[model samples]
Target: MPAHIGRPVINLGAHRVDTDALIEHIRTTYSDPDEHPRMGVWERIIRNAGVTQRYWTRPLAEATATTGVARRAETAFGDALDLAETAARRALDDAGLDPGDIDGIITSHTTSWTVPNLDVHLVERLGLRPTVARMPLTTLACAGGAHALVRALYFAQARPGARILVVVAETLSTIYHQAETTPQSMIYRALFGDSAGAVIVTGVTDENADGLGPGLLADDPFELVLPGSRDRYWGTIDDDGLHFESTRAAARAAADSLPYLTDWIGNRAVEWVVAHPGGPRIIDDVVAGVGLDPEKHGRHSHASLAENGNLGGAAVLDVLRRMHDDPPVSGDPGVLAAFGPGFNLAAIYGCWA
Candidate 1:
């Protein structure tokens, strides 16, 4: 059985943060020359990230303030679970299905460190059956949504008549620690938001798998990790909180994986692309690497960045949601791609159905 993914529902954070306002606040707060000697580079990176606005699950001040690991973890997990529940309920309604219709649950979250992950909490809150299969992915970051969908495809094939619900939620705004002064850290501070997204994958007959509907059915899924590139992005512990860092080489990591991706794409005529809105460069790299028409495709990606910054694990689903809003021609061939901490790449080859 082939699996057809349904349209997703998104729930955004309540606290809106404007890029211009954020820029002003950072300038004033980190004004000491001795502390931030290279403030100019940091400012440029933030400005060039192309994020006009984003939202924080908590107040902007608290999200950026120096806080202990335990406090940050508690707050981030609380907000993430709330948003996830809302998105899951909306997704069930969108698919015209009940909570019992879901035979399996897949959740991807990485914003906080905690035991008894979001999957079990969601299962309890949504009133799902205790026997429903569950898969929890905790560290994929921006690639979480794409990876979950990849897993759902196989789950559908295995169970034949199964229906799987995939959920992704992230409180990335919690990463904004004022203790970090690197240019990369500044770019990250400007490039993330808090959000949750959920969608359903239903097992369908072969005839219904390759045609036009509201979404792309899963036909093929691919992943790649570049050699010796593990350090492109990583995390560390500090007195303030968990800190995510990106190397200067990280800017080129997405494009660097293109050769392997293109080899997989082969002769497939790609009519569209759903790129993760990690930043301006990531989107541009997709457009360039895949030979997509810059004037037309990947608009959803750029739009997501401008409207909501980066929603971490929820970023790709938001991109897919925009694709659903203004749909493509029936049966259009496209690829979904995202990058994460391991310098890992995940892509799905599918067509509009």
Candidate 2:
């Protein structure tokens, strides 16, 4: 049975910050003349990051304040769990299903260091039955959203009549550490936002489903890892908090590994695409690598980045939500893909229903 993805719901942070203002604030924080040299470069990078505004779980002053890992984890987890619950409720309501209807739950959360993950917390908070199956992805990073949905598809296919709830929440603002001055860290300061997104997946196509809202009929889920590409993207933790690190190869990793995606999409006229808003480079590569028009097919992905910054695992979900504004014709073939720290790629092909 083909899995159908219902409309996704997204929740962003309370604190919204414009890119320009954020750049200026960052400069003021690092007042030393020597720091100015590096801050100067980051300012240019921020200007070109293709982001207008982003949300943070905490206030700018508090978020940018250096802190211990234990405190960061306590706050980040509280924020993520709160955000995920809201998104999950909205998603269930959108699907016209009660919490009891979901038989399986899949969640991806890497921004916070939490012992009991989102899946367990959601089941308890949402009043789901204890027997409900759970799958939590803690290390997928930015790719976690699409990664969770791909797993949801598998669950729906494996169990007939199963309805899976997919949720991803990130408090990316917690990674803003004043101590880290690397270029990659600087770009990250401009590149990420805090968000949570959720959607319901059921094992039924348009032909079989009765009251499902406008969404995609999912199929052909795929995942890949470039051999010896571990260095492309990785994360580390320290006294200040989490840090996102990347190398030059990370810039080209998407383009390098997209051939496998294009291969699987062979001979199919993929009419639309929802690529991860990792940054401008990843979006551009998805356009060229997949042979799609940036103006038409890639516009929503760009819009997500411009408006929300990169919402980590929530990016693909946010992009999918935006597609409804300029929806494709029913049955139009499309692809959704996300890349994260492993230089890992998770993709799912579908058609508007």
Candidate 3:
């Protein structure tokens, strides 16, 4: 039996920051007398980041304040919980199921560190059964959303009637630092937003599962961790908070992983390509690498990035939501892919129902 993915719901932070404004803010906060020579270069890079606007839980002023890690973590934890709960409720509603019906829950997040992880918090707030199975995932970074779904699919398959809730939330804005002058850190401020996304997955035999949504075929779900590519994209924690390490190689990693993805996809007719919009460059690279017709399928990924910035693991789900809103013809096969730290590539094959 296959696992079906119900409608996905997304919740973004309250404040939307324009890219130009963000660039100016970065210039004021991160610019140094010694780095004056490179300020022009930094401006060019920020303008080309492919984000026109991004949403945040707090305004730029609040985020850039001289706050300690404890304060930032507190803000992140609260914001994450609010967004995660909201997205989860919306997803459950779309699936036409109740919280009590959820037999298992899987959560993926990386923007903050906390005890009692999100799954535990959600189970309590959502009124799910205490006995419900729970899995909380971290460290997958931007790939966490798709990876969570992949894991949920497996759970659904094992427990025939299980209805699983998969939630991914990231409050990346909380990690922004004025002290970190690295180019990657500066770009991160302009490229990422706070957002949460949730979806419900159920086995074919699950109650009220008469094909309510797209089916995740049990045949092929693929994951690849590129050898020695860890440095392409990663994060480090210190007294200042989480600092991101990103190289130009991060954008090209998707193209590099394409051969492996193609091999995993085999001869399947992939009519729609739902890819994580890592950035404009990454999106273009993946389209070219996968042989996709830009006019036909490229907009799906671009729209997400242009509108939502990078929501980390929540990004793939945002793209999925867009695809669902304007669906393809029934029986059309599709591929979903996302890349994150570990230079990992996670993908799943599905068909429109």
Runs in model 3 deviating more than 4 A are: 30-37, 206-211, 214-219
lDDT for 81 (candidate 3): 90
lDDT minimum window of 10 residues, candidate 1: 205-214
lDDT of 2 by residue, 1-353 (tens): 67888778999999998987898898898889878878778888887888999999898999888679989988998999999999999999887889999999999999878778888899999999899999999999899999998999999888866899999999999988887778888789898999999998888844558766678888779999877889999999887778888898888899988888999889888888989998888898897678888777788888999999999999999999988767899989889999998889999998998
lDDT of 1 by residue, 173-239 (tens): 8888887777778888989999999999876776544442578777888998888999899877676
Rank order by lDDT, top first? 2, 1, 3
Clashing pairs in 3: none
Q: How well does candidate 1 score on lDDT at residue 137?
A: 97
lDDT tens readout by residue for model 3, 71-121: 888788889899999999998887788899999999998888899889999
Using TM-score as the measure, name the better of candidate 2 and candidate 3.
2
Question: Which rank order by TM-score, best down to worst?
Answer: 2, 1, 3
Candidate 1 vs candidate 3: the TM-score winner is 1
Clashes of each: 1, 0, 0
